[model samples]
Target: MKNKFIKISVCTLALSLLLGSCTDDILDEQSRTVYTPDYFKTEAGVIGGLTGMYAHLRYMYGQAYYYNATLTGTDEATWGQSADGNFKDADLSGVGNLNSSSSRSDVLWNTAFSNINAANGIIENASAVGISEALVSEARFFRAFDYFLLVQTFGGVPLDLGSGELKFNVSQNRTSVRNTVPEVYTKVIFPDLVTAVANLPDAGRVTGGATKTVARLHLAKAYLTYGWWLENPNNIPTYPETPRTDPDGHNAQWYFQKAYDIAIEGIDNPGPFALQPTFYDVNVATNDRNNEILLMADHTESSEIFNGGSLTFGSGGAPDNFAGWMLTWNYTSLVSGTTPAWTAKVSSVQREAAQPYGRPWVRMAPPQGVFNNTFADKVNDSRYDGTFTTVYRGNWDKTTLIGTNPVLYGANGIAVEPGDAIFSFLNEEPSQPIDFSNTTYNSGIGAGVLPGRADFVLPPSRISRRVYPGLWKLGPYRTDNAGGLGQPNAGSTRPFNVAKFSELYLVAAEAAVKGAATQPGKSARDLVNVLRARAGKWRYSNADNAVFIQDNSAAAVAATPAVIDINYILAERSREYFGEGYRWFDLVRTQKWNELAGTYTICGPNLTDVTPQTFTRTIQPFHYLRPIPQGQLDAMDMPDADIEAYQNPGYE
Candidate 1:
């Protein structure tokens, strides 16, 4: 809050100058010239105005470290990393922090709002100056997008609809708590998106590209999120997370249909926006700015500068130095404990698999006794490869198992075990299973090992043989995949920080499945297969494909597809977007948030076993709205907001 002017608030200052006729005064001097409202009257200005909104977002997301820590890691979820207590202490109380806007801690907060302000400014002034009519829609859509981030992250926030209000109400007591999810959908989210759909020009709506289609995508998302949030009193979607029960749940169907309607309308025809169908070049280190990335903020330049570290990751200054789970743990790339070296010791979760070496720090694993078989056996799961890659030829061959091979190596690789002095606190390991030709136990004599046992019992050292064992190399991080597994030790970029478009696809796919779109098949079952096939999963089509719609309902999803099932769709959302921080909000929308509500633990294997999941909130039916900061809450009182309660009002 100290340097509120640091990039974010500077947005307000810049915008104010635009609305008033005093813009010429700001440009009074030629050398110290400032681009005023009149300046943006040109094509460059129009582009720059849009660019300004986009610039705020580019500085916002995508560091494997941040993705892991905040989204999937202990920062938000109860992934195993919280087991020992290293990060996100409040969320993972013992290890996380509040005032430490350290990395992207508040990036989502400031950037989203700033972008929103800029967007509003663009919309407010673009029309007055006669900027392209198309640009106005794009601006409005983007402004809505910024609002989406705010609503999703902090729940209901003050609605700053236009550039007219000249009030400095940044103080807490100046606003209200939690806007109705419906109100948000009807007003801010829907209007802008609809305007986007009509006014967003024909800007070559490429795959990763933004255009009317992108507007449609978010609108669909807004509908789905809104319905799901209000599905139940607690915000726990009507759907259940386990084995997919009651897939239909509430008015999810109605919303899903609307989502689909918009998606189809945006395209007008199928041929154009069809997926590019090219395989993901997993080798592309970063800068995955291809058309594949739909609706993303432009971070192409930042994405390409890949290395051992980023502003999103690190500890005590050495930069690249990190904790392991950053790659595989938190997000649904894999469950921890399943892969040996990538155990709770490596991540904090027990069931998630550990990435070979594409390490971030907050590796994802599951609870102590929970086996991630649901996720592990998804060999053909689309998210699998997107999350972690397959490295070896055969399955785990138990007999020749050493504790060093990557998770992909057959036998001869590291054997799995439970956490303890022998394993990790998360408990449990790979069955160290053997490929069978009548129960074969070897990696055929020349095989490898698992998480490498050198540090099997150590206090989590970085270079432990067991820690960086052959298990890592066998992963998508096979830095030498192009070298055909022969060359083992080159520090590779692609081999680090595993990422896949699968996550977003699933988001889109489910959006479709839930009636959010008009893909060829209206059911999620087919989409599931599409994803599974992409992950190289075995023939995903099941006997139930015919009855998928019927089998999938609010009460049950037994391989049927007679009708769309939102809960089942969500189950996939969970499986596909796990650890990606999808659950945090998914819980809210589906109204199943109570599953993660109340007291929870961050449990870690390195430090204390349990840490509380305390966070700032507004009130019941308003819990999703985060509390206003105490200082701001106190300063702005009476006439507007409830200053007294707004000041860190959680205790009451």
Candidate 2:
């Protein structure tokens, strides 16, 4: 229950100052300057250092560029119309290239090591300071967390930052060595997470604190990922040129079975986490920080200082939760008119500080395949409706454009009001013929018109790199925007969810499909059905803009194939966690990135260019691992050959 933010200084690592305080959330700011070893030996210093671990998440999670690195270039997303090199480079479609410098994965690389050092300092000195083992386990969890991310991203980052392995380095040193992938998992990630799971309490000490279930989730995931590495199903190459053998003398199936057991254990023993009754409830802005979320990078709307970024505006920088804006198209460009011929235009769906109408950067967009295939059963499954902002409603009342006439002319010259649907990305092609010609009402964004509907409609196939359904799950949400457009430009105050309880189901199913032995009533099909059944029960329809209750659990569960394969599990994962930044890792873990995401289809950037164009990614065996960041290599004082050896295989 004791939640206080403290800032501690380490000799080599430049840990940032902590900001703001909320009950249950540990990322509040308070400053103190102290040297590492002695500082962590004190009780205040230990707590302060632990708080730094939570704060470091802000540096990566909500940062838009880093978020783009995780989802873009994968099947779930592509570079949008306004995408710059950061996005285009990741796409791997030849527009630009992903390399050591341009890759936004640097966000993780830069932020994680500093915090890892902080965690190291805490783990070493906490016990001496009389800090509880429970408190120390928090440090242990973070240590493993960073290394897990590092090993997955760069394939063998240094475990010994400057000193001996896992030791708190008290002096600055530049030279570094990359460990083999096997060494990282054995020496750091797996061991620390195992201890963390055993020592951490069922309930978090503070809001958003690490707990047993979270530790179990990561530990299980580590086993699952390591299992895939051992199997090397696709014969993908590894970095540092290490063999895919586990140091612990276990085979891939051993790890797979362990992954399944631990995940099921976590699911059965969920202390304060469980699935939300409906997917809509899980992501609704009002329902932020719900129980379904196991871990998140915490943020707040109350104060600019506490939020770690401006509440009124954001520059799309680190510590700002602006990732949502990247997938958001420029909906404010939509024009409605006063006359039947639609000459006098006004912005009908003005940008607002609400869940659906956040500021748009148009940096990354979903491919048409996401709409047509991944979520083909739009009616039986609520995930498609829950995941995207398909409808852009009129909020002109919130702007000065509402002057005198409360009504505006829309598609088919129908009169529209403030709450009417202005434009919509239809879930499916309408039975009625849609007129795509721009001669009528210039809907501005290449949207078409149906006969009776006032809302301009674009069917599934019409989705483009310029305009597609915005990621509704990650949109901005604010309670302070009273009567007018609030700070839509500001980063979202909502916590960026990092892990969810529902993922345990997917992880277990994936492991089971990989030849792990399943328990009674816990087969791969059974595990997937748990979530599919939940997808059927919908309490609110996002498209209809109303509370329409329906339970299609029978149909949803019945639709599940009797035999579930790895592909089905991957498809289900996309439905559950799309655009939430889980795609790349999921595909990478199962070695399905090239197979699933190699070819994708999307229309051109211009509104009128709705013809789908297929693009191919040149994913090579060496691309399985991202390049070791150029900045890290440049900072080190190693020889040119040593540095060349230090980088991942492809980037050189």
Best by lDDT: 2
TM-score of each: 0.59, 0.96
- Candidate 2 stretches greater than 4 Å from native: 2-35
Tell me the tens digit of each residue's lDDT in model 2 across 587-608: 8988999999999999999976
**Pairs of residues clashing in candidate 2:** 18-29, 19-28, 19-29, 20-28, 20-29, 24-207
Write down the RMSD of all candidates, one decimal each.
12.0, 3.1
**lDDT of candidate 1 over 1-652, digit per residue (tens):** 1101111111432222122121111111122123444545455555555545543443343333333334432213433332233233224333444322222334455445545655655665676667766777777877777677656655555564222331222222333343434445566777888888777644433223346656766786776666555444443221111221123343655765666565445444322334423223321233234433444432211222323223332232211223233433321121223343332322211222223333333444432111133234332343333333222111122223322433431122344332211222111234563122312222211112334331122111121111211212122232223322221122222222222334334445555654454566534565554444443422212211121111112222233345545555555555544444455556555554444333332234332232322333211344343334333333342554454433222322
